[model samples]
Target: MTQNRRWRRVLIALFVVVIAFTGYHAVRTVSDAIYWNAHRDEPIERWMTIGYVAHSYHVPPHVLHQALNLPPMPDRRPLGRIARESGRSMNQIEAKLKYAIVHARPPYPAPGPPPRPFMPSPSSSSPAK
Candidate 1:
């Protein structure tokens, strides 16, 4: 009986570990899918809008997307109206065409090294590194 209990405990621990791993990778996998989509056949205007909105709000790209309400507005709708409705700032509005909303995939970084893996070391990140 003790042996059975021990094995069961181990099995439970293993299952929990697997679940944690899946949760972590699932986030990365979904993000990577978006990153790839942005790079694949996406127009220059769409890419520029993300950078413009993100910088204007002083927020990360993901937050900017969330702020704008993802999946984008219909092409026919004006960006200015959407921005005003969403309570976004003028700089962000200027970043996008007069009033156009694009799809939600994150923008691809211009010619540069691929996104570096997250490092726990503070010095390894930022200019301080």
Candidate 2:
């Protein structure tokens, strides 16, 4: 019957659409995976916390803050903000900080003993013999 043919055509069209949608997503997913594999070692550009970057580089947060020339603070902020405030691109800031850490100077010499407090000698209090 004509109604049966119409239903069959509709079903076929719907099947084709579903298959296309699924195939498109599958291709996109594969492409993304390939790109990630190729650039796994590259630095990411999205906003990231200073803590994350320092951790990734195996450097302490305070050390990274000092290396970046950022003012002392209790906690880290987003890298994008840091880069903007410093008038540099996010990538450039990250690169410079990474490079500085890799080539940083050796640690400063150990601190010396604390100075002793002044104490008046027993003989000095009175007249020496």
Candidate 3:
């Protein structure tokens, strides 16, 4: 009887430990997700960083990634390698790129269609010159 009780106690302890672990992980995941959603910014930061490097070097993504020191940000695939190789920091590259694009956008074209005065057609009532 004692042995059976001890085994049962061990099983219960193991079950409790597993339940506790599972609950902890579940709570952690939920909290992390909530935080991420709350703080997430819409614009993708990694691409912006990589794009900055590309603009600076006048090269493709592979070449840029072949050049800076950027963290492993998702969507920065080929460019990350270039940036790390080139020793250019991702933050600096991103800043420069953002500034350039924002400043470079052309102003809206003149509001309305071109102004053309109406002229009577020669085909209707007017005689051909």
Candidate 4:
């Protein structure tokens, strides 16, 4: 009977720990969502990576890379690093990224077949003969 009581206590403790852990993550997720939503339209910064900028501004990373003349890939390097490597000023890189974001076009899905025009049947159009 003591062993059974001890096992119940252990299970209760385990359950409490799990609940606390999940609650912490849930709170963190909500806070992050709020922060990102608030800053979604913030201007680009030199310290930000291309991926971050793309995510914040809803622009494609490939478009930003093309604007900067970088090869197409998942480049995680920060804008400051890219500027240093390319021998360009941070301002120049920022300008290019901003331009790309402004001019970036949303990718459209492939075209589907055109809808057929509606036509009434001859009998209906002419009414009862």
Q: Choose the strongest candidate by TM-score.
A: 4
For model 2, which pairs clash? none
Cα lDDT computed for each candidate against the true fold: 0.57, 0.73, 0.57, 0.89
Q: Give the per-residue lDDT of model 3 (tens digit) for 18-45.
A: 9999999999999988875653223435
Scored against the true structure, residue 43 in model 3 reaches a CA lDDT of 40
Give lDDT: candidate 4, residue 51: 90
TM-score of each: 0.29, 0.45, 0.40, 0.77
Q: Which ten residues in a row have the lowest lDDT in candidate 3?
A: 63-72
Q: Which residue runs of candidate 2 sit more than 4 Å off their true CA positions? A: 43-81, 87-92, 99-129
Ranking by TM-score: 4, 2, 3, 1
lDDT of 1 at 67: 51
lDDT of 2 by residue, 1-129 (tens): 999999999999999999999999999999988875664224634476766666555566677678778765754567788778778887787777777656554566899999999999897799757
Tens digits of lDDT, candidate 4, 55-81: 888888899999999998998888989
Give candidate 3 misplaced runs (Cα > 4 Å). Answer: 42-92, 96-129
lDDT: worst 10-residue window of model 2 = 37-46
Candidate 4 segments whose C-alpha is farther than 4 A from its true place: 105-129
What does the lDDT read for residue 89 in candidate 3?
68
Q: Which lDDT value does model 1 have at 24? A: 97
